[model samples]
Target: MTQRFEYDVVVVGGGPAGSSAAYEAAKNGVKVALLEKEETIAETVRTSGVTWIQNIKEFGIPDDCFNPIRNFSFCSPNNEVTISDTVPRAAVLDVRKTYRWLAEQAKNQGADIFT
Candidate 1:
Protein backbone atom coordinates (compact mmCIF):
# COMPACT_ATOMS: atom_id res chain seq x y z
CA MET A 1 0.00 0.00 0.00
CA THR A 2 1.12 3.55 -0.75
CA GLN A 3 1.50 5.81 2.27
CA ARG A 4 -0.21 9.13 2.16
CA PHE A 5 0.69 12.20 4.21
CA GLU A 6 -0.97 15.55 4.55
CA TYR A 7 -0.24 18.84 6.24
CA ASP A 8 -1.87 22.21 6.61
CA VAL A 9 1.23 23.86 5.23
CA VAL A 10 3.91 22.52 2.92
CA VAL A 11 7.20 24.35 2.58
CA VAL A 12 9.83 23.60 -0.02
CA GLY A 13 13.56 23.90 0.56
CA GLY A 14 15.33 23.24 3.82
CA GLY A 15 17.12 26.55 3.63
CA PRO A 16 16.68 29.33 6.13
CA ALA A 17 13.53 30.87 4.71
CA GLY A 18 11.60 27.64 4.19
CA SER A 19 12.74 26.21 7.49
CA SER A 20 11.79 29.40 9.30
CA ALA A 21 8.33 29.37 7.81
CA ALA A 22 7.80 25.77 8.73
CA TYR A 23 9.16 26.31 12.20
CA GLU A 24 6.91 29.28 12.87
CA ALA A 25 3.87 27.49 11.51
CA ALA A 26 4.56 24.42 13.58
CA LYS A 27 5.09 26.52 16.68
CA ASN A 28 1.64 27.98 16.23
CA GLY A 29 0.05 24.49 16.20
CA VAL A 30 -0.09 24.11 12.45
CA LYS A 31 0.72 20.78 10.89
CA VAL A 32 3.57 21.57 8.54
CA ALA A 33 5.97 19.63 6.37
CA LEU A 34 9.34 20.84 5.12
CA LEU A 35 10.78 19.38 1.94
CA GLU A 36 14.29 19.71 0.59
CA LYS A 37 15.44 18.89 -2.90
CA GLU A 38 18.90 18.05 -1.73
CA GLU A 39 19.64 14.73 -0.13
CA THR A 40 20.64 16.66 2.95
CA ILE A 41 20.15 20.08 4.30
CA ALA A 42 23.00 22.42 3.42
CA GLU A 43 24.41 19.76 1.15
CA THR A 44 26.28 22.61 -0.49
CA VAL A 45 26.91 26.09 0.79
CA ARG A 46 25.93 28.40 -2.03
CA THR A 47 25.56 31.74 -0.28
CA SER A 48 26.62 32.07 3.34
CA GLY A 49 27.92 34.93 5.42
CA VAL A 50 27.80 37.02 8.55
CA THR A 51 24.76 38.14 10.49
CA TRP A 52 23.81 39.97 13.64
CA ILE A 53 24.14 38.43 17.09
CA GLN A 54 20.50 39.09 17.89
CA ASN A 55 19.46 36.96 14.92
CA ILE A 56 21.42 34.07 16.30
CA LYS A 57 19.61 34.29 19.62
CA GLU A 58 16.22 34.80 17.95
CA PHE A 59 16.79 31.79 15.76
CA GLY A 60 18.13 29.84 18.72
CA ILE A 61 21.19 28.90 16.75
CA PRO A 62 23.76 27.18 18.93
CA ASP A 63 27.17 28.69 19.65
CA ASP A 64 28.88 25.81 17.91
CA CYS A 65 27.26 26.77 14.61
CA PHE A 66 28.81 30.20 14.44
CA ASN A 67 32.02 32.06 15.10
CA PRO A 68 31.49 35.41 16.78
CA ILE A 69 33.12 38.26 14.96
CA ARG A 70 34.07 41.48 16.66
CA ASN A 71 36.04 43.02 13.87
CA PHE A 72 35.75 43.72 10.15
CA SER A 73 38.12 45.12 7.60
CA PHE A 74 37.95 45.94 3.92
CA CYS A 75 40.64 47.10 1.54
CA SER A 76 40.67 48.51 -1.97
CA PRO A 77 43.20 50.05 -4.29
CA ASN A 78 42.45 53.53 -2.96
CA ASN A 79 40.81 52.97 0.41
CA GLU A 80 40.73 50.81 3.46
CA VAL A 81 37.88 50.38 5.92
CA THR A 82 38.05 49.00 9.40
CA ILE A 83 35.44 48.48 12.06
CA SER A 84 35.67 46.85 15.46
CA ASP A 85 33.76 46.48 18.68
CA THR A 86 34.77 45.13 22.05
CA VAL A 87 31.59 43.13 22.13
CA PRO A 88 30.71 40.89 19.28
CA ARG A 89 27.47 41.90 17.62
CA ALA A 90 27.80 39.68 14.56
CA ALA A 91 28.89 36.21 13.60
CA VAL A 92 29.97 34.08 10.64
CA LEU A 93 27.94 30.92 10.45
CA ASP A 94 29.15 27.49 9.53
CA VAL A 95 26.80 27.20 6.57
CA ARG A 96 26.41 23.46 6.26
CA LYS A 97 26.14 22.82 9.95
CA THR A 98 23.92 25.81 10.59
CA TYR A 99 21.50 24.74 7.87
CA ARG A 100 21.23 21.35 9.48
CA TRP A 101 20.66 23.03 12.79
CA LEU A 102 17.80 25.04 11.33
CA ALA A 103 16.11 21.90 10.07
CA GLU A 104 16.52 20.37 13.49
CA GLN A 105 14.92 23.41 15.06
CA ALA A 106 11.88 23.01 12.80
CA LYS A 107 11.71 19.33 13.72
CA ASN A 108 11.85 20.23 17.38
CA GLN A 109 9.06 22.72 16.80
CA GLY A 110 6.91 19.77 15.60
CA ALA A 111 7.25 20.21 11.87
CA ASP A 112 7.87 17.10 9.81
CA ILE A 113 11.01 17.27 7.70
CA PHE A 114 11.61 15.25 4.56
CA THR A 115 14.99 15.37 2.97
Candidate 2:
Protein backbone atom coordinates (compact mmCIF):
# COMPACT_ATOMS: atom_id res chain seq x y z
CA MET A 1 0.00 0.00 0.00
CA THR A 2 1.15 3.53 -0.74
CA GLN A 3 1.25 6.08 2.00
CA ARG A 4 -0.35 9.47 1.65
CA PHE A 5 0.39 12.73 3.42
CA GLU A 6 -1.04 16.20 3.42
CA TYR A 7 0.22 19.62 4.38
CA ASP A 8 -0.97 23.20 4.26
CA VAL A 9 2.07 24.15 2.22
CA VAL A 10 4.19 21.94 -0.03
CA VAL A 11 7.57 23.32 -1.12
CA VAL A 12 9.41 21.82 -4.08
CA GLY A 13 13.19 21.36 -3.99
CA GLY A 14 15.56 21.44 -1.02
CA GLY A 15 17.62 24.44 -2.02
CA PRO A 16 17.95 27.60 0.07
CA ALA A 17 14.77 29.19 -1.24
CA GLY A 18 12.54 26.20 -0.64
CA SER A 19 13.99 25.51 2.78
CA SER A 20 13.63 29.13 3.85
CA ALA A 21 10.04 29.24 2.68
CA ALA A 22 9.16 26.05 4.49
CA TYR A 23 10.87 27.23 7.63
CA GLU A 24 8.99 30.52 7.69
CA ALA A 25 5.67 28.88 6.94
CA ALA A 26 6.09 26.34 9.68
CA LYS A 27 7.18 29.00 12.14
CA ASN A 28 3.86 30.72 11.54
CA GLY A 29 1.99 27.52 12.53
CA VAL A 30 1.41 26.32 9.01
CA LYS A 31 1.93 22.63 8.24
CA VAL A 32 4.67 22.54 5.64
CA ALA A 33 6.45 19.82 3.66
CA LEU A 34 9.62 20.16 1.59
CA LEU A 35 10.20 17.73 -1.28
CA GLU A 36 13.61 17.13 -2.80
CA LYS A 37 14.24 15.01 -5.90
CA GLU A 38 17.77 14.13 -4.94
CA GLU A 39 18.35 11.05 -2.81
CA THR A 40 20.48 13.30 -0.64
CA ILE A 41 20.51 17.09 -0.78
CA ALA A 42 24.29 17.22 -0.82
CA GLU A 43 24.84 14.34 -3.22
CA THR A 44 25.04 16.38 -6.38
CA VAL A 45 26.50 19.87 -6.42
CA ARG A 46 25.09 22.54 -8.74
CA THR A 47 25.88 25.94 -7.28
CA SER A 48 28.88 28.20 -7.87
CA GLY A 49 28.78 28.86 -4.09
CA VAL A 50 30.23 32.37 -4.23
CA THR A 51 28.64 35.03 -2.03
CA TRP A 52 29.33 38.27 -0.20
CA ILE A 53 30.62 38.36 3.36
CA GLN A 54 27.78 40.64 4.40
CA ASN A 55 25.34 37.97 3.32
CA ILE A 56 27.21 35.41 5.38
CA LYS A 57 26.96 37.57 8.49
CA GLU A 58 23.29 38.35 7.88
CA PHE A 59 22.44 34.71 7.30
CA GLY A 60 24.54 33.43 10.17
CA ILE A 61 26.53 31.09 7.95
CA PRO A 62 29.09 29.00 9.83
CA ASP A 63 32.74 29.92 9.45
CA ASP A 64 33.80 26.33 8.79
CA CYS A 65 31.40 25.97 5.89
CA PHE A 66 33.08 28.64 3.76
CA ASN A 67 36.44 29.96 2.72
CA PRO A 68 37.07 33.68 2.83
CA ILE A 69 38.30 35.24 -0.37
CA ARG A 70 40.19 38.45 0.34
CA ASN A 71 41.70 38.83 -3.10
CA PHE A 72 40.41 38.86 -6.65
CA SER A 73 42.05 38.97 -10.05
CA PHE A 74 40.75 40.04 -13.41
CA CYS A 75 42.53 39.73 -16.74
CA SER A 76 41.98 40.81 -20.30
CA PRO A 77 43.87 40.68 -23.57
CA ASN A 78 45.70 43.93 -22.83
CA ASN A 79 45.11 44.67 -19.17
CA GLU A 80 45.26 42.71 -15.98
CA VAL A 81 44.60 43.69 -12.39
CA THR A 82 44.59 42.08 -8.96
CA ILE A 83 42.84 43.48 -5.92
CA SER A 84 43.39 42.51 -2.30
CA ASP A 85 41.79 43.56 0.95
CA THR A 86 42.71 43.10 4.57
CA VAL A 87 39.22 41.80 5.28
CA PRO A 88 37.24 39.42 3.17
CA ARG A 89 34.56 41.06 1.04
CA ALA A 90 33.28 37.72 -0.27
CA ALA A 91 33.65 33.97 0.16
CA VAL A 92 33.38 30.56 -1.49
CA LEU A 93 31.18 28.07 0.28
CA ASP A 94 30.92 24.33 0.44
CA VAL A 95 27.60 24.13 -1.39
CA ARG A 96 26.64 20.75 -0.01
CA LYS A 97 27.12 21.81 3.58
CA THR A 98 25.25 25.07 3.06
CA TYR A 99 22.26 23.32 1.54
CA ARG A 100 22.19 20.77 4.33
CA TRP A 101 22.29 23.53 6.92
CA LEU A 102 19.33 25.32 5.39
CA ALA A 103 17.37 22.11 5.15
CA GLU A 104 18.16 21.32 8.75
CA GLN A 105 16.88 24.75 9.77
CA ALA A 106 13.63 24.10 7.96
CA LYS A 107 13.31 20.73 9.64
CA ASN A 108 14.00 22.24 13.04
CA GLN A 109 11.24 24.74 12.40
CA GLY A 110 8.77 21.84 12.06
CA ALA A 111 8.91 21.55 8.30
CA ASP A 112 8.87 17.98 7.04
CA ILE A 113 11.75 17.40 4.64
CA PHE A 114 11.53 14.55 2.13
CA THR A 115 14.54 13.68 0.05
Candidate 3:
Protein backbone atom coordinates (compact mmCIF):
# COMPACT_ATOMS: atom_id res chain seq x y z
CA MET A 1 0.00 0.00 0.00
CA THR A 2 1.13 3.53 -0.82
CA GLN A 3 0.30 6.55 1.25
CA ARG A 4 0.47 10.06 -0.16
CA PHE A 5 0.58 13.30 1.74
CA GLU A 6 0.14 16.86 0.53
CA TYR A 7 2.71 19.56 1.03
CA ASP A 8 2.93 23.23 0.13
CA VAL A 9 5.96 22.52 -2.04
CA VAL A 10 7.44 19.25 -3.25
CA VAL A 11 11.04 19.22 -4.43
CA VAL A 12 11.88 16.32 -6.77
CA GLY A 13 15.66 16.14 -6.35
CA GLY A 14 18.30 16.26 -3.67
CA GLY A 15 20.86 18.01 -5.84
CA PRO A 16 22.21 21.52 -5.34
CA ALA A 17 19.27 23.31 -6.90
CA GLY A 18 16.50 21.26 -5.36
CA SER A 19 18.21 21.10 -1.99
CA SER A 20 18.85 24.83 -1.91
CA ALA A 21 15.31 25.63 -2.89
CA ALA A 22 13.89 23.31 -0.31
CA TYR A 23 16.13 24.71 2.37
CA GLU A 24 15.26 28.30 1.61
CA ALA A 25 11.56 27.71 1.25
CA ALA A 26 11.33 25.74 4.45
CA LYS A 27 13.45 28.25 6.25
CA ASN A 28 10.90 30.88 5.39
CA GLY A 29 8.22 28.82 7.16
CA VAL A 30 6.87 27.07 4.07
CA LYS A 31 5.95 23.43 4.16
CA VAL A 32 8.34 21.58 1.87
CA ALA A 33 8.90 17.95 0.92
CA LEU A 34 12.14 16.87 -0.73
CA LEU A 35 12.19 13.67 -2.78
CA GLU A 36 15.26 11.85 -4.06
CA LYS A 37 15.20 8.80 -6.31
CA GLU A 38 18.74 7.68 -5.77
CA GLU A 39 19.90 5.86 -2.67
CA THR A 40 22.83 8.28 -2.60
CA ILE A 41 22.12 11.91 -3.35
CA ALA A 42 25.24 12.74 -5.32
CA GLU A 43 25.41 10.68 -8.52
CA THR A 44 28.46 12.12 -10.29
CA VAL A 45 30.31 15.24 -11.21
CA ARG A 46 29.08 16.16 -14.68
CA THR A 47 30.98 19.46 -14.94
CA SER A 48 34.55 20.49 -14.41
CA GLY A 49 35.67 20.37 -10.79
CA VAL A 50 37.17 23.85 -11.00
CA THR A 51 35.28 26.69 -9.42
CA TRP A 52 36.11 30.20 -8.23
CA ILE A 53 35.58 28.97 -4.65
CA GLN A 54 34.37 32.48 -3.79
CA ASN A 55 30.97 31.37 -5.04
CA ILE A 56 30.75 28.77 -2.35
CA LYS A 57 31.89 31.29 0.24
CA GLU A 58 29.16 33.64 -0.87
CA PHE A 59 26.66 30.86 -0.30
CA GLY A 60 28.05 30.37 3.23
CA ILE A 61 29.51 26.97 2.36
CA PRO A 62 32.36 25.79 4.52
CA ASP A 63 35.91 25.80 3.17
CA ASP A 64 36.76 22.46 4.76
CA CYS A 65 34.70 20.67 2.14
CA PHE A 66 37.36 21.32 -0.54
CA ASN A 67 40.96 20.22 -0.92
CA PRO A 68 43.27 23.18 -1.47
CA ILE A 69 45.31 22.36 -4.57
CA ARG A 70 47.61 25.29 -5.30
CA ASN A 71 49.20 23.80 -8.39
CA PHE A 72 47.53 22.22 -11.43
CA SER A 73 48.67 21.35 -14.96
CA PHE A 74 46.77 21.17 -18.18
CA CYS A 75 47.50 19.25 -21.38
CA SER A 76 45.68 19.01 -24.66
CA PRO A 77 45.35 16.13 -27.16
CA ASN A 78 48.54 17.30 -28.90
CA ASN A 79 50.32 17.86 -25.59
CA GLU A 80 49.90 21.63 -25.86
CA VAL A 81 49.21 23.91 -22.93
CA THR A 82 45.93 25.35 -24.15
CA ILE A 83 45.14 26.93 -20.81
CA SER A 84 46.99 27.21 -17.54
CA ASP A 85 46.44 29.37 -14.50
CA THR A 86 48.23 29.59 -11.16
CA VAL A 87 45.42 30.22 -8.75
CA PRO A 88 44.87 29.15 -5.18
CA ARG A 89 41.94 26.81 -5.56
CA ALA A 90 40.61 23.52 -4.27
CA ALA A 91 39.16 20.32 -5.67
CA VAL A 92 38.34 16.72 -4.72
CA LEU A 93 34.99 16.77 -3.03
CA ASP A 94 33.29 14.00 -1.13
CA VAL A 95 30.10 14.15 -3.18
CA ARG A 96 28.18 12.00 -0.76
CA LYS A 97 29.21 14.16 2.16
CA THR A 98 28.29 17.35 0.33
CA TYR A 99 24.85 16.03 -0.51
CA ARG A 100 24.33 14.77 3.01
CA TRP A 101 25.27 18.15 4.39
CA LEU A 102 22.92 19.96 2.06
CA ALA A 103 20.12 17.58 2.90
CA GLU A 104 20.82 18.14 6.57
CA GLN A 105 20.57 21.89 6.09
CA ALA A 106 17.21 21.44 4.39
CA LYS A 107 16.06 19.15 7.15
CA ASN A 108 17.17 21.62 9.76
CA GLN A 109 14.95 24.19 8.12
CA GLY A 110 11.94 21.94 8.75
CA ALA A 111 11.81 20.25 5.35
CA ASP A 112 10.83 16.61 5.16
CA ILE A 113 13.56 14.92 3.12
CA PHE A 114 12.79 11.44 1.86
CA THR A 115 14.19 9.05 -0.70
In terms of lDDT, which candidate is strongest?
Answer: 1
Q: What TM-score do all the candidates reach, one by one?
A: 0.89, 0.91, 0.78
Write one digit per residue (lDDT tens) for candidate 1, span 16-110. 99988998999999999999988899886788668898999988889999999988999999999999999999999998888888888889999
lDDT of each: 0.90, 0.89, 0.76
Give one digit per residue, the lDDT tens place, for model 3 in 1-115: 9998889999999987888999999999999999998876676545444555666666566666666556666777777443334775555555556666788899999999888
Better of 2 and 3 by lDDT: 2
* lDDT tens readout by residue for model 2, 2-115: 999989999999888888788789989999999999998777777799999899878777898899998899999999999999999899998889889988888988999898
Error of 1 at 74 (Å): 1.3
Ranking by TM-score: 2, 1, 3
Better of 2 and 3 by TM-score: 2
